[model samples]
Target: MIESAFPIVEVPDMEAALRFYRDALGATVVYRFPPDGEPLFATLQAGSAQLGLGLAEGATAGEGAGMLLWFYVDDVDATTRALSDAGYLVLEEPSDSEWGERVALVSDPFGTRVRLGQPIAPQPDEE
Candidate 1:
């Protein structure tokens, strides 16, 4: 029924936010409007999801917590380590959960919480 979705973040400075997404999160610029002009809006691909960053009039950047967007990856540890190495703030270390998932959390420059997770192999059933 649902077609598709993407998360949009409002930023005061679109260029700086775009740089943060591209450098820290390892996102590739998929589609950017206005060519070489200052980016008022841009789309970036992080893993499978498309993240949008836009500049709005009189918008002040605020640090927000408790809101998290989760992304599924093949290797949680590797992704986390790479993000950390790229200067991203690692909020949580990679750890396995009882629910059969390995996950890590990080914070972006714009204060967006991102969760990276990978499913773990199921345990054998007891006889």
Candidate 2:
């Protein structure tokens, strides 16, 4: 049985990756192994999700396909602002989607696309 799931991102440099996650995404360092050094594996907490960062031998950002991860927030505007202020690049500004969600797309320093979304206001009772 799968108890939980988390995304692991391969980065060129673990230290820089950790800094980006910590500073840009406001992720907190939960637990880190091999605590004695840099270029090691570390885990971070963003809301209820956990993201792992590891040193990729020779991998580059955006080397893979498909959506890496998505984070759901209560307020898209606030989240976007926070990420922007923290030095992340905002690929797409927050906008209400036709599917009924306020979403903003952001790219992390490591080139991972983070889809931040908040449920739209419930439509008033239909007549």
lDDT of 1 at 101: 87
Model 1: lDDT equals 0.78
lDDT of 2 by residue, 17-83 (tens): 8767787667898877787766467889988778888777775665265655687888999989988
Candidate 1: tens digits of C-alpha lDDT, residues 1-127: 8788777877777877876778755789888776788878889998777988888775543246446768787899998998888787888999988777898988766667778889877632321
Top candidate, metric TM-score: 2
Q: Once model 1 is optimally superposed onto the true structure by TM-score, how far is the C-alpha of residue 96 displaced, in angstroms?
A: 0.6
Model 1's TM-score against the true structure:
0.75
Clash-forming residue pairs, model 2: none
